[model samples]
Target: MPEGYEDVCAEQAVVEGGLLGVKVGGEPVVLSRVGGQIYAIGGICTHKPASLEEGTIEGGSVRCPRHGGCFDIRTGEAVRPPATRAVPTYEVKVEGGRVLVGRRAG
Candidate 1:
């Protein structure tokens, strides 16, 4: 694996249309699969420090349960308010059935 990246799980651990929350090096992250593509994003809502896992996935966006705000999973864009700041997105890779997540070094 590359630097700053850690293996999260096997590909099969996250089913389609499902979300998996995990901590990588003490950073909270949420992984989800949509349209056969895996997406990794910050697990906390931008409006407040709350777990994003409480929300529901709707198509390409995940709805914030606390304020009904929505975010685009692909680009981590704040699609609705109560959350104007965009959430952080991570690079995801599937190698030999293992899922890995990491922040690319600039």
Candidate 2:
């Protein structure tokens, strides 16, 4: 999202229990390590731009802190009300302890 903001490391994606949320280009990005795979998605609630990182992460979904809206962390699909819009999801790739997020080039 920012200039020269690269992906995160595979190790950094996970510590011991779950994935890690990181900020890239001033935007919140959720990084999940599920089943040994890394997934990246928008970490902000679409309804009011609430930080999803501070919300609950369960069953591959992240809940909004502002409202009770739920979203699929992998697909960025809003699964509940109060958030009719879907957030942006990015493609994640792990290489040699490094994770890379794919974005549309300008």
List per-candidate RMSD values in Å. Answer: 1.7, 3.7
**Model 1 clash pairs?**
none
Give the Cα error of residue 97 in candidate 1, in Å. 0.7
TM-score of each: 0.92, 0.78
Pick by TM-score: which candidate is best?
1
| Model 1 RMSD, rounded to 1 decimal | 1.7
Put down candidate 1 lDDT per residue, 21-92, tens digits, no spaces: 988778888888999998888889989878887787898997888888888999999998889988888899
State each model's CA lDDT, in order. Answer: 0.85, 0.71
Native-vs-model 1 lDDT? Answer: 0.85
For model 1, the stretches where C-alpha displacement exceeds 4 angstroms are 104-106
Question: lDDT (0-100) at residue 24 of candidate 1?
Answer: 74
